[model samples]
Target: MPAVRLSDVAQDAGVSLATASRVLNGSTRVPGKAVAEKVEASALKLGYVPNAQAQALARSRSGLIGLVVHDIVDPYFATIAREVQQQVFASQSQVLFTQTDREIDTEIRALRSLIAQQVDALVLVGSHRYGNDSDAALTALLEGFARNGGRVVGMGQSLGVGRTIVPDNAAAAHELATALIVGGHRRFAVVQGIAGIPSAGDRTGGFIAALTEAGIEPELSIEVGLTRDGGHVLAQQIQEHLAAAPDDPVGESLPLCVFAPADVMALGALGELRRLGIDVPGQVAVAGFGGVPDADDANPTLTTIALPLHEMARQAVDWVLEQPDEGSAIGPEGSEGGAAHEAADTSPEGSAEETPSEVHVRGDVLLRESTALAASD
Candidate 1:
């Protein structure tokens, strides 16, 4: 059987094809209420399914928001995604989400796909790779998106196209470092994630800088993959190092502290430490960032700097859906109007554009059994 077309519905309802399209697409420009009701009834009776592409072209909006995240399975991303999903649905729109596994090329592809579909807005929930060739391409893509009237918002770092909600990783790590120092932890080891990643770098940098200012140096610092296995490997290496030099002053210290800037890595380290029969806070202490839900329920209760992920998600959704200001690049439809272009006045590629308006969220430092002071203190 031939597919039912918009004209068929219009004919069935005794209305013009334009009226049927306006009714089906829910356009604000529809003519009469009675015609709309008749058109709806005819579409239902005729089993008509509107072409999304055609409707988008006619109505100048897709009512779709695209979200790009790195590793949705990670609790950090999961927490924020949940809130973003809820807020987008509440606004009578749908979400198109994808995961990029922290790969810049993969992220760029995801952005391209979303832009191809002409998503009304975009929310990117991860750190931007800055000062690199890939960043320049990403910036160009975002600038084109902005020129076409699409709104963009970022969670971890600036994407140069729109507002960004950056957590103060450096500040939070410094705070955690100071707390550890005050808790009588003079010896330290750090299990750091891949270098150049903003979140990991900032946290590690801040902690080291603070400790250095206090006249203490880390006993060991190991670079590892940003994964559980990385943390597990670091734990084993720490044990080996201690075994090889049992009487070394740093190795002899009670409650030797180890900081992993991500909770997943910390949990992995904790598991390995327990398997080795090490007494946490008695022999070694573990601390982490990202107050994922599982942290509070862990055996020793993770000490961490809890990022305001849910709140950040809420603000991101709200900001992306906000109406474009007059004379702003965004068009009436809120998307880039189906073409890729760059605004002349958009900030330099790969650099943040100073928008007077932005949403800022803070992190909280939580002390727990995993990082408690030694008995002497």
Candidate 2:
């Protein structure tokens, strides 16, 4: 059978083709209530599907947003993706996603494809490696995209060219380290993630600066990929370092506190340590940044900086949608749109109305048992 078209719906509803097209293609010049209802009912009866290109042409809006992330399975990105979807849906649109595996070339290709699809806006998440120079190609693409009327939003980091939600990663890590030192932690080690990735680098740098300011130096430093498997490698390195050390006369040494710049890495190290029969907090203490959900569920509860990930996601959604004051949210039917949210810090004079405003939000340091957090809050 032939596919039902707009002309067919028009004939069936006794309306002109132009009127049917206007009604079905999302044109702003809508007809009167009765005629619109008739055309809609007729289109439904005839199973006429409107062409996406035609609808976009008529409305000048595609109602689609592009979301780019490194890995959807990563809990951190996963949380942001979920929130972006809900917020996009609430605005009566759809989300198109692409994962680039943290590869620059792959990211370029994925974004080009999204532009071809004519997404109305973009939400870019994950690391912003080696500013301007390395990102030149991606930046050009984004600038062109913006010129074509599509909005750009950067979540979790600053992307120089677009509106951004920046987290105070370095500051938070510095505070966490200071607190641990005040709690009498002396011997220290650092496990760093990918060198150029901004977030991990900031955390490691901040933690080290705090120790240096307190007149102490980390005894060991290891760099690895920002992954759980990397954390396992960290555990082996720790084991080797401890094995080569001298023990005190009483056959015991001060506990070594190790800091992994990410929660996933810390949890991985913690698990591997237990597997190696190492007693946590007795011989060694571990801490991590980014308070991922799994951190609290870890055996001894991982100490971390609880970042406002949900708030960051929402702010990105709001900027891309240009609806900071629009409070509705999409959820399961019968659920209210209003729910209490984690507080976010916005630039005092910046509003979503601004084209390229930057909002900065900070995380709270939660010292848990992984660092042998005391009962005091």
Candidate 3:
């Protein structure tokens, strides 16, 4: 038997093809209940199955979503990726997952690949290198995708052409830093991640902002990489700085604290502090962001800020699957509309409105053995 088509269903139901199409597509605007019933009955009797590809061609939607991330190895990203997969699956759509390892070239390549695959939408998580310099390239590519009827959303920090979901990095950092300060730690060391990443900047800013508000001059240090090893290096630098002036009142007697931008980095800082015979919380307090599960299991449970990575991912995927505004061109490219294009084009004034789907889940400060009041006091 030949495959049943919309035309056949419409003919059998004594309705126009357009009405039959609307009914089969589950549109609720059909004029009457009886008409909708007739169309549905005709479709069932004819064993009609909508050709998804053909439907996509007609609707300009592939029903495929793309999820692009910076690094999968990082537990934070891993947790987010898992949530994204679950959310996308529930929407009756498939996902194309890719990782860029924080490399611009890799990110560009991943974007191109997703575009070629005709994904209906995109979700970018923790992409580091997007800004005005690459705006033209990103805009052109996203516009083309939109013109082809694709949507895009962004996750994490960075001005991009989509909705964003991110942790309240700045606020969380400020809160965590304040916790250390209230604990009587007057002298502080900060371990910041890669310089250009927005998350890193936000975290560092938060730490500095807190110190500034407390009337304490911030001693800032930045690391080029975002990893445990980078934290370890900063740890060594802190030790060296202390050694150079062991007899100084601030260096010898002031409570010392280290604020690592991420939990993994905090773990590394802990390792270095231990190697140098520094007692956690007893001699120096350590704090970090992104409360991964392993943080609790660490020798000294990490005192850190908990970012709801999974929830953020789930929300991001949900936003990406949402319907685009009617009559909105995909982005000057004549493709379907995308959040990425709008984000890219958003001006400083409009940025607050067009900022990608960021769901700022409040972060809690988790106090553990790793941080405490100064032992001497």
Candidate 4:
């Protein structure tokens, strides 16, 4: 189908090309009021739509926000992305989404593409792989974006590049650990995600730290992909491990608890457990992170950490739309602050310049049937 161009509207309204452009593009130099009304009516009648890119270039604002995530299929990322889309839409702006599959280089390419497209701001949602050359390269790229007047916001890992909404992964995992400990199960196993992702490390590390602090060493630690298939594979591994001591009941003769740290993985693990004729809580209690909407839909429900995904995404957009105060950039500290910004103060040295800020969001622990207290015999 052919698009309705400005010329089409002009001809239909018996107006000049320049007049049609002015009326449709919000140009200050519009024709007479009567002519403008006629052109608008023509556009409406013909369903003419202005070119957003051309309009953005003329106004020096694209009205487009860029969003990058790991996997859109994952509920964690989906929830946040939906909120971002809603918030951006509310502001008369739109979102450009990209998925990197947890690859740093792929993420970098996505950001670069968004930058080339002249997006107003960049919002990154997913894990951060820090302490590497890629991290330095990413920092350089973000710094360049900032220099070009583009804003950057992070969700899980800050990368120390922009305003970051960090979730207290470790603290939440610690709470989960505490809950499991109080439930009277000691021997433990972990089905962890890809090795270098900081968010993954933070969750597993926090749980392990808490167990160590309690003088309990975990029995098994299995590394796998950050997918449901990974969880299923981990389930197979568990079945093999338990088969060696078939006579001993899990959480009793062997006394075991499993932590997957991600709801999808835990749910997959649950399916595998049922396939192997294992009873949850009765055989091995399980816990996960990310209180996805369907957590309660699992056969026994899931015990996990519920993150404020909508709030975080909404704030990401809000921060992007917010005007930086004179001198300092916006931080996530005060009423107008968040994380850190560029050292170059936009305001005078003596004046109150807003610094860049970091907004750390905490997760709530939901204890459900999967990780419920063991039944006393």
Candidate 5:
């Protein structure tokens, strides 16, 4: 069978080829209601699919959104990706998704591919910075994309590029730590996420700040991947700490509060601990960030800073799809911002403006059984 073309639709609709193109190809020049209805009906009957490139050319819009995430398998990013995909589809657009696996080169490659595809906008989730030369190529690609009038939405404050939605990671962690302290948790350990990723740093940094304020220092600050594998490594460290004081059974009287900045990592650590026959909140209490659904389902429910992952991802979609009248070029210089994406002021002192290029979101702390301080028998 031959592919159905514009000519076929036009012939079936008893309209000109140009009229069928205008009606089905998303040309800005819409035909009259009756003509459009006729063209659409004929195309539907004929099973004709409009060429995406042709539609893009007709409307000066691609109807495509590029979403680049660190790891789609990570529930945090998975939730965001799911929300973004749904929202974009609702807007009659499609999402072009790519995963970076937390590697800079992979992310750079993904960005290059998306740019080449000429996606109308982009939503970048959970890419963190190492604050060095590794950032150069990534920065260049983002800058060039924005310069070329492509809209970009940043899910976290990685390099502060693009119109950003920042979660109050530090404050949320601070509050969670303070809550644990009030609950009589003394000995503490923080399993940090990938070094240099802003989300990991902010969350772990926030937790440490609370300890510092209480004149309490953590017994351990271990750095690891923000993934489950990182949690496996964390469980080993916990075992070492327990061995140092095996006399107390590592519970109640000497329980350790192990905090992982991301829920995936925390869940990872929890699973490993259970595998090692170490009881949670009995021997060790655990908490994590992002509040992924799996946290609630863990053997011992996990504690976490429950961020509005779905809503935040929605905001990223809304920003990218809505797009400013003239998108502000993304960089340290900031863009011409008369349109606002509202949130807390994390920007510098003199950088205040009537409408901001960035938005801030806060998370809620949930203390679950995973972090309960149960007394020993």
Candidate 6:
């Protein structure tokens, strides 16, 4: 038997080859319901399989996008990837997800692989710092993609080329830190994510800014990684720090509060605190960012700033699908003013000028049993 082609399917359906192509491509602008049904029925009867590469060549689009992420196990990135997949599906495009494991070399390799595959666009979920020596290499890679008329969007932050879709980390962190301050917390401990990552820096800066606004000197503690284990280790270190402090003559317990940059870390902190017989929100308060679903179901519901992962994913796809403009060169910078720019550019037209599109869909600070007023001396 000969392999069935688009012409064969169209002839069998009594329609033009273009009609058969449009139907298989999932175009919504096809003529009418009857024509669409006929094309679909013919396709089914012939058991036709469209050659993706040939279709791409004809349309001048690969119909595929690359999604590069830091870690697949992390709930935050996992949820965002899921939403991205759905959005790509709606656009009649496929997604190729690649994890870099926070390594620059891995990220570069992933980008190169995506380019070789001829993806229509590149979506970088989370990437680490590129070295000075490797800067040219990275730039050339992105420039080549752009020069070829491909789109690239960042889910976290990118140095150059394309747009970024991210939450209001600084504002969200400020809000959560202010909550601790309002609760009368003075002595603070923080567990940071990867040292140089933009998201980590934004979160840490927000925490410091909140403490500075209150005229309280913040005690800084940084963990190497951003995982749950990182938070657990930091929690133990905080306990050790407290133990080393000289006992006050008045028996006054120091106001202790732990600010984890991510909810996974916060959960780890809670676990360590409980293991040490320390009551959460009783002896100390714990707060984190990126409200993972499991946080709400924890032994004590976590107090977290909910990042709009799904909405961010959806907006990222939209940005990639839209035509790039001169303003597309602007990438996310870890500063209050930079955040403002990102928000303005990504937002829908005629909406609040100050309201950033990335931050628009953010979830509220959910207060649960995990936090409470600081204990008195």
Off by over 4 Å in 3: 1-60, 127-132, 158-160, 219-222, 251-255, 275-277, 323-361, 374-377
lDDT of 4 by residue, 1-377 (tens): 89988899999999889878878886657789999999999999999989976566444467888899888888888888998998999988889999998788898888878888778778988776645689877877776666556677788887566578888999999988987887676788986656667788889989999899988888888988777887798888888777786554433554467898788888888888888888886777778898887677997898899988787877788777775452323345422322122233342222232234577778998889886664567
lDDT, candidate 6, equals 0.70
User: Per-residue lDDT of 196-245 in model 1, one digit per residue for the tens?
Assistant: 47888888888888899889989888888666777788788878877876
Residue 26 in model 4: shift from native, Å?
5.4
Clashes of 3: 18
TM-scores of all predicted structures: 0.83, 0.84, 0.73, 0.82, 0.87, 0.79
Relative to the true structure, how large is the alpha-carbon lDDT of every model?
0.78, 0.78, 0.70, 0.77, 0.79, 0.70
Ten residues in sequence with the least summed lDDT for candidate 5: 336-345
**How well is each residue in 267-361 modelled by candidate 6, as lDDT tens digits?**
88889888987778766578878878878887688888987777777767766665322222233221111001112125322222111223233
Q: Candidate 2, residues 1-377: lDDT per residue as tens digits? A: 99998899999999999999899997889999999999999999988899987887776678888899987866778888999999999987899999987888888899888877878788899775555464898877776666455667787667765567777888998999999999878888997657558888888889999999999889889987677887899988989888998452223356789999878789889999999888887777999877788887998889889888887888778666653344323211111111011112321122222245566778998988888833434
Lowest summed lDDT across 10 adjacent residues in model 2 is found at 332-341
RMSD in order of candidates: 4.9, 7.8, 6.7, 5.4, 6.6, 7.6
Residue 162: error of model 3 in Å?
2.8
* Global local distance difference test of model 2: 0.78
Q: How well does model 1 score by local distance difference test? A: 0.78
Error of 5 at 275 (Å): 0.9
Worst 10 residues of 6 by lDDT: 335-344
**Model 6 regions more than 4 Å off:** 1-3, 14-38, 127-132, 246-255, 323-364, 374-377
Candidate 3 whole-model C-alpha lDDT, 0 to 1: 0.70
Per-candidate total of colliding backbone pairs = 1, 0, 18, 20, 0, 1
TM-score, prediction 5 = 0.87
RMSD of 3: 6.7
Query: By descending TM-score, how would the candidates be arranged?
Result: 5, 2, 1, 4, 6, 3
